[model samples]
Target: MATTLAEFEAKVLLDQTLSTNHKSIIIPIELQEKEDSLPTNRFNKLFKLLIIYCLVLLVYPVYLGYAIYWHNINSINISWCEGLGFLLVVSTLVYTCLCYSFVLSPLVDHISFDIRFPGSMEKVIQSNEVRCAVSSIIILGCIIFLIIDTQDDRYRLVSAGGILLIILFGFAFSANRKKIVWRHVIWGIFLQIIFGILIMRWDSGRDFINCIGSKVDTFLGFTDSGSSFVFGYLVDQKPFLPTKLENGSLAKLVAEEINNSTAVKNIVVFKALSTVYFFSFLTSMLNYWGILQWFVQKIGWLLQTTIGTTACESLSASANIFLGQATTPFIIKPYLGQLTLSEIHAVMTGGFATIAGTVLAAYISLGVSSAHLLSASMMSAPAALAFAKLFYPEKETSRTKSDKISIKPPSEVNVLDAATQGASSAGLLVVNITAIVIAFIAFMSFINSLFEFFGDQVGIHNLTFDSILGKLFIPLSLSMGVEWNDCEKIAKLIGVKVVLNEFIAYRELGLLIQNEELSPRSAVIATYALCGFANPASIGIQLATLNSLAPQRQADFARVVFRAFISGNAACFLTACIAGTLYNEFTYVQL
Candidate 1:
C-alpha cells in the first residue's frame, strides 16, 4: 500500500515538477517525510527549548513594566516617549519568536487556497496617472491651507516661498536638465513633504519619532555606566551635586563652577564622542541578528521603488542614515564597478547629506534635538535622490534597476566576536573627531587672527572669519525664512558648517541658544540646515572610499563627485526650508 523511500526518490527524480508544491514553495516532500520518520524524542527536545524561550520573551515585558512603575512610584522622572519605544523594541523581539515558532513543528504538506484581486483594483494600483493625480491633490490642498492661514498673518507665506526657492536653486545647477525625470522628482518631493508634515505637524507621527529618538538617547547613555567605572570622577560629576547638601546656595554655585570649567567641558566632549564604541557594538550585534540588514533592505526597497534609483544607490542612501559615509559605500561594494555615473553621484550625495547614528550622541550632547536629528536623517534620504537627479540626471541604463540586492553579512565568528570587532573600530572615529576638533580649531584661530590684523589695518574693528562668512551668506540665511535681524547670525553658522564641520557649527549654535541670542524658530531652522555632512571633507572621504572599491571607474566619476557636493548642500537647505514651512509659532506652540 506504501512506497519505499527509494521508489519515492525515483519518482521525484523522474518528475522535476514534483520538487515544488502547489503553492510554488520548494518542498522535497519525500525527503522531509524521511526526516519526520525519525524518533519523536529528538524533535520534542528542540520544541521544548523553543517553547521555553518564547515563554521567557513573553514574561520579560511584565518585569519591564514593573520596573518602570516602581521607578515612577519612587518619583523618578521617566519620559513616556522612551517608555513607549522600549516596549516597542521588546514587542518586536517577541513577534520575531512567534514567527519562528513554526520551526518547533515539522514541515507540513501544502493545503489548497485561492487569493485574487479585482481587475479594477489592480489597474488603479499600477496606474502612474492616478498616483500623480492623488499627489497633486494633496500638495495643492496643503498649499491652499497655508495660503488661507496666511490671510490673517503674512509671515506664514515666507517659508512656503522658501521651499520654492530651494527647489529652483537645485534646478539652476542641473547638469542635464533635459533628461530630468519629473515622475521620479515628484515622488521624491512627495515623500519628503509627507514626512515633514507627519513628523512636525501631525501629533501621532511626532510622538512616534520622539519615541524612537528617546529610546536611542537612553540606549546610548549606557556607555556612561561603563565609562564611570574606568574614567572615575570625570563621569561622576553629577553625584557631586546632590540636592541634600546643607548649604544649597553655596553648593549650587560650586556645581556651576565645576560644570563650566574648561577641564569638565573637555572631559564631557571626550565622553560624548566615546559613545561611538557602544553604538558600533549595537550596530554589529543588530547586523549579526539580521536586524540591521533587514531594515536596510526594506527601506532600500521602498526608495528604489518610489524614487526609481538603482539598488546600489537606494541601499547605500538608506544605509547612510545608520552607518557612516566611510562604511556605507561597502554595502554596494560588489556592484560599485557596475554602477552608472549618476548612480555613483547619488550614492556619494547621500553620504554627504546625512550623519551616522554613531555620532548622534555627540551632536545631541551639543544640545541639538535628537528627534530633529533623526527626522532630518530620514528626510535627507529622499531629498538626496531628488536633488542629485536634478544636479546630475542619470544618462545610462542602470544594471540593477528595480532589482533587490542582498546585504553583505558580517564575517565575524559570533556575536561576541562582533562586539570585540565593533568596539575596536570605534577608536579610529573617536581619534578622527578629536584630531579634527583640536587641529582645525587651532588652525582656524590663526587664520582669524591674521584676518583681525588686516581688518584693523583697514579701519574695520573686530572683523573675523564669522563676520566675513556672515556677510557672504546673508542672502542664503534670508532665503531660509529667518528674520532679517537674525540672517547674518544664521548665515555665519551655515558658512562655518560648509567651510569647516557641523560639529563646530553645532557647538556655536548650542552656545547661542544658551545665551538666548537666537529665537526658537531661528534655532529650529538652523538645526535642520546644519544637520548634514555636506562639507568639503566629505567629498574627499567619499572619493577615497569609492576609489578603493572600484579604482577603474574613479576617473570618470571625479567631476561628478564635486557636483554631488553641491547637491548634498542643497538637499540639507531644502530640509531647512521645509522646516520653516511646517513650523508655525501660533499653531505648533498651541498644539
Candidate 2:
C-alpha cells in the first residue's frame, strides 16, 4: 500500500514512542515494509532529479553545436552561437529555479543522503592511488598525442610536456596530499582548457569576447573624457602646440621649457592613475542602480551551478571580476559569519587571482591587450575556486545553500550624491595606489642597488633583481610554452609580479612591448600570468580587510591567507598554460 503524509507522520511518532518506551514492543511486519519503501521512494525521486539535470546539461551543449552548424550552413554569422549559448543558459537557470521552488524545496526536508562512506584511511589512500594513476595516464596520452601530431619541431612539444609536469609537481608538492581533492584539480585543468579553446580558438567565441573588449574600451574612453574635463590636458595625452611669442623673447622660450618639463613629469599621474577615479564612480553608480548586482548574480549563479560552491563563495568570486579584492567582501557581508573555511579560502583566492575593472583601463594604457585582460579576468573566476578547493577542501558544513546572492547597494541617495560618493571613494583608492607604486618602486630600487653592489664586487657587474628572478623562474616560464630565448624575460615579469604587485609588472611589460623585446606569443602568455593580485602585500591587505568585516573569523583568515596567495598564483598560471597551449601567434594583434 502507498503511504500518505498522515501515515508517514504517524509512523514517525510510533517509532519515537517505541524508542522512548523501556518495554520492547512488537512492530507490525507491514509497517516495517512500508518504512523501507519510504526510503526507496525518496532515493528514487532524488535519482530521477539528478538524471534529469544531467540530461539538461548534456542537451544544451548538443543544441549549441547544432545551432552553430545551422548558422554556418545558412551563411549567417557564427556570432549567433553566443546568443544561443545565452539562451540555453537562461533556460537552464529558469528550469533550475522551477525545480527548486516546486519540487526540491519540499523534498529536501523529507530526504537526506549521507554521501560520506564508512571506511576512512583505506578509502582515502585508494582514492589517491586511483587519482594518480588516472592523471599519469592522461598526461602520458597528451604527450604522446603532441609528439605524434607534430612532424617538425617535436622538441617544443616535449618541452611543453616537461613544463606541464613541473607545474603539476610544484602544486602537488606544496599541497596537502591527504586532504587535496584531485577531482577538483582535474576539473579545474579541464575548465581552463575549455575556456582557452572557446575564447582563443573558436571563431564565435573570439567574436563574442572581442565584442566585449571593444565595449570595455569604449566605456573606458568615456571615463577618460571625464578625467580630461577635470584634469585638463593632464589626464588626456594630446600634442601640445607651442605659443608663438610676438617679440620672440627668451622669457617665452623659458616658459615653454618649464611647461614641457611639468607635462613630462606629470604624464604618469595624469595618464595612468587619474582615469581610475572616473571609472570607479561610474561603477558605483551602476551598483546603486542594481545593474552591477544583476550582472554579478547571473555570473555567480553560473559559477555556483557548475563548480558546486556555496552562494557566498560564488558571489564573491564573480564580484572580483568587477570589484577589487578588498571591495568584494562587502557584497556578501551578511553571510560572512557562516562561511566555511574552504569557502573563505575560495573568496580570498579569487580576489588574488583576478583584478578589478577600474584598473583594466590603467593596464590598457600600459599597452596590454584589452581582450586578453578581459578574458583573463573572466577565466580566473572558476580557476580560483578549483585551486582553492584542491588546496583546502571544505570540511565544515555550510549554514546556507541558497543560490540567491545578496549584494548591499552602495548608496540610497540620488545619482548626483552617488556619483559624488563614488568619486570620493575613488579618490582614496587613487591615493592608495599612488602611494603603493611610489613606495614599492623605491624599495625595489634600493634592493636592486644592494644586489648590484654585491654582484659588482664579485665581477658580475650586470647583476640585478630582475636577472636573478629570471634565472630562478626560467623553468616556470618555459613550462608555459614561452620560447627558451624569451623565457628569462617572461620569468622576470612573473617574479616581479609575485614579489611586488601586478602594477609594477604591467608597467615593465608595457616597456617590453614598446621595445619589441617579447614575441607576440610570449607577450600574450605574460599578460595572462601577470593578471592577478598574488603578491606578498596582498596577504596583509586581505587579512586587514576581511578581518574588519568578519572579526570572528580572524584566526581562520590568518591560517589560509598564505595558502590563498599560492592558490592565486596557481590560478593565473593555469590560465597562462591554457593560453600558451591554444593561442596562435598569427592571430594576436596589438590593440
Candidate 3:
C-alpha cells in the first residue's frame, strides 16, 4: 500500500505538475486493497523528460571541458588535464545535484508546504545526507590521489580532506529525511551550468566591459562627490568636490611616478593622494553612522546606479555586503523586509564571497595585483548570487517594487552632524581593521612558531604552515590546475586568505610577485584562490551584523551563517579554479 502511494506520488509530480509558475499541485498517496489504473503514456512522457534533462546536464560538462581545454591548448600537452577538467566540471554538477537533493528541496518543501519534520530520519534527509555521502566519496578519491602523488607534497589533499570532514559531519546530521527530492537536484545543477557559462564569457570583451565600467564609474560620481566632500572638509578644511582620476596616458605616467618614487622624492603628490584616500575612507564609514543613516540613504540613492550597473552585469548579492555587511544591503533597505529567501541568500553569499570598495584600496596596498582585484570583484558578484541561491533556496515572499528606492537628504540639521558621523565611523573602521589584522597576525605567527619548533626538532627542516597546508590541500589545489610543485605555496596562500582576509593574502602574493617567488602561472592561480572573504572571522562578523538587525533570529542566523560561510568559500575557490583552468593559455602574457 505504501509502495503504491509512493508510486502515485511520483507519478503526480512527474506527470502534470513541476513547473515553477503553477506549483499548486500536490501528489497524495493512499493505501487501497485493490490495484489501481496506471497511466502508461504519462509514465513514458515523464521518462523522456527525465532523459532529456539528464542529457542536457551531460552536454554542459562536455562543453565546459572543451572550453577549458581549448582555452589552455598552448600551455598543457597532456590530455589528462582535459579529462580531469571534464571530471571536475561533472563533479560540480554532481555536487549541485546533491546540494539540491538534500538541501534546497527540503527548504522549498518547508517554505511552500509549511511542512517541518521533527524526527531524525526526515531531518537527516532534509539536511543533506546524499550531498554529504557524495562529498565524502569525492574526498576519499582525492585522498587516494594524494597518496599516489608521492612526487608532490600532500597539502591540497589534506585541505580537501578537512573540507570533506565538515561535509561528512553535515551528512551525519542529515540522513534519510522525507524532504529529499531528486528532481530539484537536477534543476540546481542546470542552473549552475548556465551561470558557469555566463561567467566564463563575462570578460571576453574587455572593451565593452570597460566602457560599461566607465559609465558606472561616472554614475558613481554622485556618491563619490558626497564622500569627497566629507574627506575634503576634514583634510583641506573646506567643502570639497570629488574628481575623477583618469588612467589615461598622462595619468599612467603619474601613477608610474607614484609607484616608483622614493618616499622623500615625491612627498607632495603622495600626501595629496594619501589625504584623498583617508577622506574616501571617512565618507564610506559615515554612510553607516547613526545620525548619518540619512546620508547613507541618500548615497544609496546615488548608489542605485552602481547597483543597476552590477545587476546589469549579473553581479551577486555579496556585492551588497562587500564594504560593510550590514550597510550595503540597507542601500536597498526598502526591499530588505520583503526580500525572498533566494534574494537574501544572494545578499549574504555575496557579502561572504567579496570585499567592499573602501577596503579594495587597502588590498591593492597589501600586494594584490590590480588585475587580480578587478577580476575578483567582477567574477565574485555573479558567482555569489548563483551559489547563495542554491545553498539556501528561497521561500515565497513579496518582491520589492522596481525603482522603489530614492535618495534623500540626511536628517541632521547641520554640517557638524555629518562631520562627527564621518569621523566616528572612520575611527571605528580604523580600530576594527587594526585590531583584526594585529590579532590575526599574532595568532598566525604563534601557530607558525609552534610548527617551526616541532619541525626542527623532528628533522623535518622545511615544515611550515604552508608546507603542511600544501601537503594537505595540494590535491584540491592541483585539481584546480595549480602546478604540483607550487601547491604548497598556494596552499599557504589559501590558508592566509581563510585565516586573515584576501587583503593580507594578496599582499603576500604581491611580495611573492616582487620577489619573483612565483611563475606567472602559479601567481594567476593564487590570485583566483585568495579573492574572497571565507575565513572564520568573517563568520563572526556576519553573524554579529545579522544579529543586530534581527536580534530574535540571532540563533538561527548563527547556525545558518556558518553553512553560508562554507558555501561562500567553496564558490570563490571553485570560481578561481575555473578561471585559472580556462585562462591557462594566456599566462605567457606578462601580468
Best by TM-score: 1
Model 2, 1-591: lDDT tens digits are: 356888999999998887866244345666788999999999999999898877766876687678868877988653322465555555677667767766897999788876665688658766858767877886676556455644444434533564366356546755455666655666566656667768887877887787777766776777667667777767644334457554477867766766666544336667777668778888888888777887898888877766667888888889999997988998888888888888888999999999998888888877788899999988888888887887777777888676445666665578778877888988887788888889999999998999999999989997889789999999888887888889999999999999988999999998998899998888888999999989988888889999999899999899888889988998888778767766555564443
* Runs in model 1 lying further than 4 Å from the true structure: 1-139, 149-153, 238-269, 589-591
Query: How close is every model to the real structure, measured as TM-score?
Result: 0.80, 0.72, 0.51
lDDT of 1 by residue, 362-417 (tens): 88767777888889889888888888888888899888754446776788899999
Q: Supply the global lDDT for candidate 2.
A: 0.79
For each candidate, the alpha-carbon lDDT, in order, equals 0.80, 0.79, 0.54
Better of 2 and 3 by lDDT: 2
* Model 1 lDDT, full chain set: 0.80
Displacement of the residue 254 alpha carbon in candidate 3, Å = 24
How far in Å is the alpha carbon of 191 misplaced in model 2?
2.2
Q: Which lDDT tens digits does candidate 3 get at residues 1-591?
A: 999999999988876655632454322222121123256666889999898778756776676668667768857543322445445644776667657756897888777546777697676775667656754665465446446642344433433343344333323433232332322223222332333334333454433334333433333334335543555433233321222345556766665554444222222112222323454445544543432344333333332333221221122243343444645654554444455444555566667776665555555544555445555665655455545544554454435543554434456555566556655665566556667777887887888888988999988885667567657766656666676677778887887777666656776787888898887667776776677777777777777776666566555565567667766676676556545533423323332
